[model samples]
Target chain A: MKVTILGCYSATPRTFTNPTSQVLEVRNHLFLIDCGEGTQVQLRKYKIKFSRIKHIFISHLHGDHFFGLPGLISTFRLLGRESELHIYGPKGIKEAVTLFLKLGDSWTNYPLIFHELESKDTELLFEDDSVSVSTIPLDHRVYTNGFLFKEKPAPRKLDVKATTKHNIDRSQFNNIKNGANGKTANGVEVANQKLTLDPPNPKSYAFCSDTAYNETILPLIENVDVLYHESTFLESESRLCQKTKHATAKQAAQIAHKAQVGNLILGHYSTRYKSIDLFKEEALEVFPRVALADDGKSFDI
Target chain B: MKVTILGCYSATPRTFTNPTSQVLEVRNHLFLIDCGEGTQVQLRKYKIKFSRIKHIFISHLHGDHFFGLPGLISTFRLLGRESELHIYGPKGIKEAVTLFLKLGDSWTNYPLIFHELESKDTELLFEDDSVSVSTIPLDHRVYTNGFLFKEKPAPRKLDVKATTKHNIDRSQFNNIKNGANGKTANGVEVANQKLTLDPPNPKSYAFCSDTAYNETILPLIENVDVLYHESTFLESESRLCQKTKHATAKQAAQIAHKAQVGNLILGHYSTRYKSIDLFKEEALEVFPRVALADDGKSFDI
Candidate 1:
């Protein structure tokens, strides 16, 4: 899994910092998350393939999160995109997006499918043979949902030397990979574990932003390989988190600790601070594994 | 008048280039014209004061023209703006902008007034003591209008030497500047022209973009000091102009020539061209004193 942070600042886009937007690549799919203003330009700066993004997930209806969607959709049309685009966002996103398109009289030639999310409960949003995506309901000023991407367990790998010694028929290779027992040439039953080896462990990532310190999400994101949590402030300003519905670095670290994730990625930094190194410093007090997210930065997990 | 080109390229935003957006400074007012996506960042990069922009004129509803508006408005709110903002655009722009704000439940604290236009004829959109802005109807894919910014003829400057020689009292200075006759010390009436000289010829700038070759705007923009016209294509691609509702550099130059504009500024070049110098080269064929508009470039008119 690879995660690219297109923008990680909070509230507004500026000359040097941008608002929230990221790209998560897993199992051959490039999922765009929270497309803030100027995301298209950032995508260009990062040299990401625009055509490869088939699905976009918006956390909320805030301008910093979804303001770029209309422009992006319009650009796709201008570039003559033929594949359908799927948008998963808040309930009111459809009206907000379609209204502008209608006003401009510039409807897309390609299909635009909006998956409006209003559910307060954790719900499965997408699933395929290799991967699955679901919502992690978050507590924010508005209705918001962070996404959880998890790769499905792969089929068992064949122990070629063990299989050959067992005289397993080549036709039974498929069955063996499916954890089925294979018969030897002497008609003796062989255990499935004797012919097959365990496959590599699956990877997972959870993205949460614009949320307060809420522990209810722990169960939903438990043991994820990487967790990107919003750290809009440090412990010094933890007092402001409640009113703003944002999380401080220490709060995010506490949540990550409770969830027992492999590592925690901190992002959505407020521009008020002089340095983001302070955020990492504050988060380290609660969580041992902490990484800071900056614009144009990428991580491999 | 100083005009800053934030992003003059056509179609979509990209790395190292932008879409349609400009800052026109006239009569101490910083007016934002056609705020395409990424305009706020461009404004910051170009060091234009965001708070000074009280008025924004959107030429059309096309994404390339006005997609950045909502994000900008949101930024104003986040920055705790107290001054009112005025937006002049198409009839449906109000609905399109308000819908997204409503979706996010993020209403501006400052008053946001919209002057929705659906006129096919020239009409004044804003007027003050020093400057007046009006709409110059243009033919484009949608209902569109370019803006005309004119410095209302300033009070004739006092010829200090002549005024003192005519013994014009300081109390009569206002009257003298207003073109009234000044009384001489010997009680002789002095000609107004002798006491006051005409103020620097009123500076005028006409911005016409995203339009086809249309002659209807000639009367509205005739004799303007500067004409910034869209030259989306070159003569080589003039064949595409008819269907795209855009103009070639030659077409823009022809309009500039017929209108007798002081100078023609060509912008909104399609990204298909390798160099914008070709646009200037093509326009100079039909008209002299032509300048090319580039992102981050400024023109003093």
Candidate 2:
């Protein structure tokens, strides 16, 4: 799995920094998360194929989180796209987007579907044969959610030498890979464990942002391969974090340490700070495996 | 009067080119016309002060014309702007913008006033002591209007030498500048023309875009100092122009010639064209003075 950060600044986009938005590539699906303003231009700058974005997941209704959605959808129509697109966002997303498109008389030519989310509990949002996505309810000024993406376990690998030694026919290889016992021509049974080996562990990623420091999401994001959390301010400005319902670097580290995730990624830095190194330094006090998220940066998990 | 082209291309914004948007500086007011997507970034890139903009005039409801408005308004709030902003656009603008802001719960602290328009006849949209703006109804697929900004004749300039020779009292200078006859100390009447030369011919700028090849607007824009007309296609694609309700380069030139404007500016070129010089060349065939509008290019009238 690979994730690309298109933008990660807080509040409004500026001359050199962008708002919250990212693209995650997992299980052959390219999913867009939290499309902020100027995301389309950033996508062009990063050379991400616009058509590859089949599904979009918005965390909340903040302007910095979803202001770019309407423009992106209009660009798709202008580019003559025909593929169906699915959008998963908050309840009022459809109404807001529909009103804007209706006023402009710019309806899409393709099938556009919206999956409005209103659940306040951890619930499944999307699922396929190889991947599944669920929401992590978060505490904020408005209704918001974090997303958890996990890859499904693959089929067991076949042990060719062991299968051949057991006189298993080639036609029975499919059954062995499916975790079933293989039978020889003589009607002797071969145990499934003897004929195949366990597959590698599946990978998982979690994204949390625009939320206060809360331990309620720890259970849902526990043991994730990579966890991205918003650190809008430093410990020095923790008071602002409390007032705005945003997280500081120290709080984000505490959450990562409690969840025991493999790696922690910090993003959504406030523009007030001249340097981002302070966030990492503050986070390192609690969690050693922490990385900074920067625009146009790519991570491999 | 000075005009700056923020984005002049038709349809969608690309990696290098932007959609329809411009900044006109006339009579101490920085008026933004047709804010397309990514306009805020373009404004920052061109170093246009955000606070200097007090009025925004949208030509139509097309996404390419006004998609960036909501984000721009939200940014103003984030920057702690306290001044009132006036937006002039089609009737549905208020509902559309209000819905988007309401969904995000991001209401602006500044007073936002909207002047919704649905008139089919020429009407004055804005006016003050020094400048006046009127709408030029245009033929298009949607309810659209072009704007004509005219600088009111300045208080007639005082011909200091002539006034002194006429022995006019200093206190009567104000009356002479106001186009009144001046009285000398001996009760001699001095003609207004002799006391003051006619204020430099009031400069005017007409902005017409996203319209078909119609001559109805010529009377409203006639003899203007500078006229900006949309040329979305070349003469070869004139057929497409009729089908799309757009004007060709030749058509724009024809209007300029008939209207007898001081200078003709061509913009809103289709992205399919490889060279914009073709538009200037074709327009120059019908009009002698023609200028091409490019992003970041400025014009002084």
Candidate 3:
């Protein structure tokens, strides 16, 4: 799995820094998270294929989170896209997007579906055979949700040498891989473990942003392989975090430390800061493993 | 008056090129015209002060023309703006923008007034002591209106030397500038022409975009100091121009030639083209004075 950060700055987009938007590539699916203003231009700059974005997950209704959605939707129509597009966002998102289309009198030529989310508790959002996605309810000024993506375990691998020694027929290889016992050619029963090996463990990733330091999400994201949390301020601005309902770098690190996540990625730095290194410096004091998310940075997990 | 081209390309915005958006500086007011997707970032790049822009004029409802409006408005609120903002556009704009604000629950702290336009004929939209803005109805796929900005003729310049030679009293200077006869100290009446000189001719600019090759606007824009017209295609692609409701460079020049405009600026080039010089070359074939609009390029009128 790979995660590309198109933009990670807080508030408005500037000439050099962009707002919050990222692409997570997992299980052959590219899911867009929190499309901020100017996201389509950043996508074009990064050379990410526009059509690959089949599903979009919005965290909230803030302009910095979903302002670019309308333009991206309109761009798809202009490009003559015929594939179905799905949007999972806050409850009012459907009305906000469709109203603009209605006002412009330019409806999409393809199927455009919106899944408005209003659940206060963690719930499943999307699922397929290979992967599943659920929400991590977060505490913020408005209703917001972070997504969790996990890979499903695959079938056990066939032990070719063991199967050959047991004289297992090729027809039974499928069943053997499914943890079934096989009858040898000499009429002896072979144990399933003798002909099969365990598959690799599944991996999980959690995305959290634009929230306060709430421990309620710790249970939902505990022990995740990777966790991306928003750190919009530093300790100096901790006084404003409470009123704004944003987290500081130290707070984000403390959450990662308590959750025992394997890897912690910090993003959504306020643009007022002189440098992002301060966030890393502060986060390192609490959590040893930390990565600062920057525009166009890609992380492999 | 000065005009700055923030983005003039047609269709979607690319890495190097932008869509339709410009800043017209006239009479101490920074008027924003047609805010495309990434206009706020472009405004920052161009170093145009945001607070000075009190009025925004949108030509139509196309995404490339006005999609940046919502983000810009939200940014104003984030910046803690207290001044009122006025928007002039098509009828549905008010509902479209207000709905988005309601969805996010992020209404602006300042007053937002929308002047929706539904007229198909020339109509006055704004007037002040020194300037007036009127609409130039155009033919496009949607209800579109181009804008005509005219600087009201300045009061005639007082001929200080002539007034002194004629022994005109200082109290009569105002009357002389207002085209009234001036009285000399000896009670002799002097002609206003002798005491005053004609002020520089009023300058006018007409902005026509996303429209077909229609000649009805010729009367409204005739003898203007400058004209910025959309040229979305070359003569070779004129066939597509009709279907897309856009004009070719040659066609734009034809309108400028027929209107007897002082200078013609051709823009909104299709992204398929390699260079912008072709637009100027094509337009120059029909109009003597032609300039091609490019992103970040500025022109003084």
What is the TM-score of candidate 2? 0.96
Clash-forming residue pairs, model 1: none
The ten-residue window of minimal lDDT in model 2 chain B covers B169-178
Tens-digit lDDT track of model 3 for A10-67: 8899998899999999878999998998899999999999999999999998888988
Clash-forming residue pairs, model 3: none
TM-score, ranked from best to worst: 1, 2, 3
Interface RMSD of 3: 1.0
Ranking by DockQ: 1, 3, 2
- Listed in order, the DockQ scores are 0.89, 0.68, 0.74
What is the C-alpha local distance difference test score of candidate 1? 0.94
Better of 2 and 3 by DockQ: 3
lDDT of candidate 1 at residue A133, scale 0 to 100: 93
Across residues B18-61, which tens digit of lDDT does each residue of candidate 3 receive? 98999999977789999998999999999999999999999999
Per-residue lDDT over A145-199 for candidate 2, one digit per residue giving the tens place of the 0 to 100 score: 9999999998889999998899999999887888889999899998999998878
Best candidate (score: DockQ) = 1
Taking every candidate in turn, the Cα RMSD to the unseen true structure, in Å, is 1.4, 1.8, 2.0
| lDDT agreement with native, every candidate | 0.94, 0.92, 0.92
Best of the candidates, TM-score: 1
lDDT of 2 by residue, B1-301 (tens): 9999999999887878888999999978999998998889889999999999999999998888998899899989999999999999999999989888988888999999999999999889999998999899998888999999999988878999998898988998787777899888889898898898777788999999989998989899999999999999999999898778999999999999999999999999999899999999999999999999999999999
